[model samples]
Target: MICIHLGSATAKNLIEIAGAQTTVCLRIALAGLLAMLIWRPSLRIDPRAVPGIVALGAAIAGMNLCFYAAIEHIPLGMAVTIEFLGPLCVALLTSWRPSNLILAATAGVGVLLLTDSAGTASWTGIGFALLSGLGWAGYIVFGKAVARHTATNDALALALGLGTLVTVPVLLTRAEDLPLDPWFLIGAVAVAVLTSLVPHAIELNALRRMEVSTFGVMMSMGPAVAALAGLLLLGETLRPVQWLGIAAVVGASAGATLLADRHTPAAPETPGEHQPIRPTPSEAVPVP
Candidate 1:
């Protein structure tokens, strides 16, 4: 999930140039446009899939907006660490294996250590991050349902479009100050592609291949990835404890994924067809 982390890093840069709400709105709009252009999904959608698509769209909008807001008041690593709780919760609830529970506790400890290293954090940021985490959990749940009931690309594209629509009122308030210079536009587009389009594209495909619990456990690496990106791109430094925290998360994720693989039940393949019982390592995260 380097792409997701990279998206987080680039989002920091974009938020500096524009307000959090505006940046998020623009990013989703551009990504939606790109998805629609490429996929050209039919206008009509199955009635059964409507609620899932709408919830998925709303969750994406909420997640991005809350995440951007959280980062405004806290360090990227800290925000991501807190926001990760949503997916970690998902992993635990979906799979109640002793190993998964242990790993979730391990991740919790790592998050506590990571946050401690960030010094005094704003409670507002913490709240926002928690809400973002909730949104993320919803995104995964509804996303899985959407992917199951509809064409993957079409569902995602439509959801993004709906997200953009939901954010329009907020975007309008800042329209007068929105950057329009050629150079700024170029950067905005780049940010939109990296932060919105790429990760969603990779993840939409990945969700179809792996179980949601497996996906969440793998995505638990996002904070570590964010920490590394912060160091390289933003010149942020991690403390010894924070380093240990990253290690804890990484180790737990690896162990859980491998454990899940060994115990995963095989499903029968269709006639004349063969599908891998478990997803590959790279397929687990879908980084490009």
Candidate 2:
């Protein structure tokens, strides 16, 4: 929803509003504040985890940078279609259910139709979007491990801290583009709230109570959400083929979730175990 609104507003005031690089830098700043307030990590450092944290931070920065760049060159919808591959890959690697295979195919068809639309988006934009997706996938894997090793709050704070450090040089290079208008700053804050803070909080809360596979299946609805957001907020209408593609991905995702629920086993009694039980080959678990 924030992305939709931001995109619309930016479209109107591209010159007045900060570009993607500046907006993302503000997002990092806001995220850093939120994480610090929530996590309040100790000054004590873990040397072993620093490399992983740094890598995750770089990936996050790269994903945002590339995504913004892609949007500048292509339609917002198409850019998102390409970026969706990141989470899709994460979901695929973590689960091998036959139903999920169908889900994957469905999403693939949707992406194909979405990108093949009238805009004739450049291969460079698509390539950048793909790179962003890969970065997102990396972010998820590393983030999960970090969360496991430390508190979610602490891990996120540390990750953001690292991200800030990594992004400073880029931010410096783009400093001249930083918006001086108070409204632009406000808009940046709004974007951070919607895109960074809200989504992260919601996903973290949801993941705590649900399985990763289940989360992935649910996230398959993102394109539909983005489309709706585009329509309602940006007055960007989708064509019939695009609508069909959205249905395919959404349907497959829902189907996968249902199938997984049927196959998951009852919980074991290890009360102290940090992680949830891994679903068996034939087992599926419902979102709690």
Candidate 3:
């Protein structure tokens, strides 16, 4: 989470100069190339894995684009809070117990407080953030499916590689805005490492361990983390109410973590949510 926000903050300066399309294109493109180099996915893969990888790729590509565009229009924390609604819904709908709704509502009310949708321009940011949420939901769903099939991050590497395709048009269109200097290259690489490479690698691994709802509940920390990133890195400020909202979000995540029962049966698979996916035997070798 810290890395992701750090990347967002880092990307902000680049976005200011290059525009959101160009900055995000560079970030994703570099990340994809690096991941492909690391994993070197086989030319042949499981046919069953294709849909999940494709969907995950599209989701990741779309989500980053929307989020980058939104941060250009609004504060990073606010954009993240709005974008969180996507996974929050996945948690609620996939939860078997009625009690989880309270957790979601607690987080929801907190986000409502953080959100200050007043002007047309702010609404435009909110609109993009909302779209990012949908893409995020797609990520949680398809990511789980893909994770179940792969022992390592091969699937993720491929998905990211495929996602680069989505950036081609954006890069071409924004070619005029892109900086050709070495400093820009350094910044773009940093953004890719912090945001796309680190976060996705960790998240895909986490999905391999826990249920989607559990992961979603835990991800309630995103807004608070992003807010801190905005304050410390971007010099953004939050109102007292927004601070309260952050507290609520943080508290909810902690509460959910403390209260979760490992033995609890996860809700059965829905479209975006899934039954607990155990790692394949290749992935399940006992830790030495």
The positional error of residue 66 in candidate 3, measured at the CA in angstroms, is 0.7
Q: Supply the TM-score for candidate 2.
A: 0.80
Runs of candidate 3 with Cα error greater than 4 angstroms are 116-121, 261-288
- Off-target runs (Cα >4 Å) in candidate 2 are 1-16, 43-51, 205-213, 265-288
Q: What's the lDDT of the predicted structure labeled candidate 3?
A: 0.81
Decoy 3 TM-score against native: 0.88
- Please name the candidate that would achieve the greatest lDDT relative to the true structure: 3
Q: lDDT of each structure?
A: 0.77, 0.63, 0.81
Per-candidate TM equals: 0.88, 0.80, 0.88
Model 1 steric clash pairs: none
User: Model 3 over residues 170-220: C-alpha lDDT tens digits?
Assistant: 788878888888998998988887787667877987776677887787788
Better of 1 and 2 by TM-score: 1
Candidate 2: minimum summed lDDT over ten consecutive residues — where? 279-288
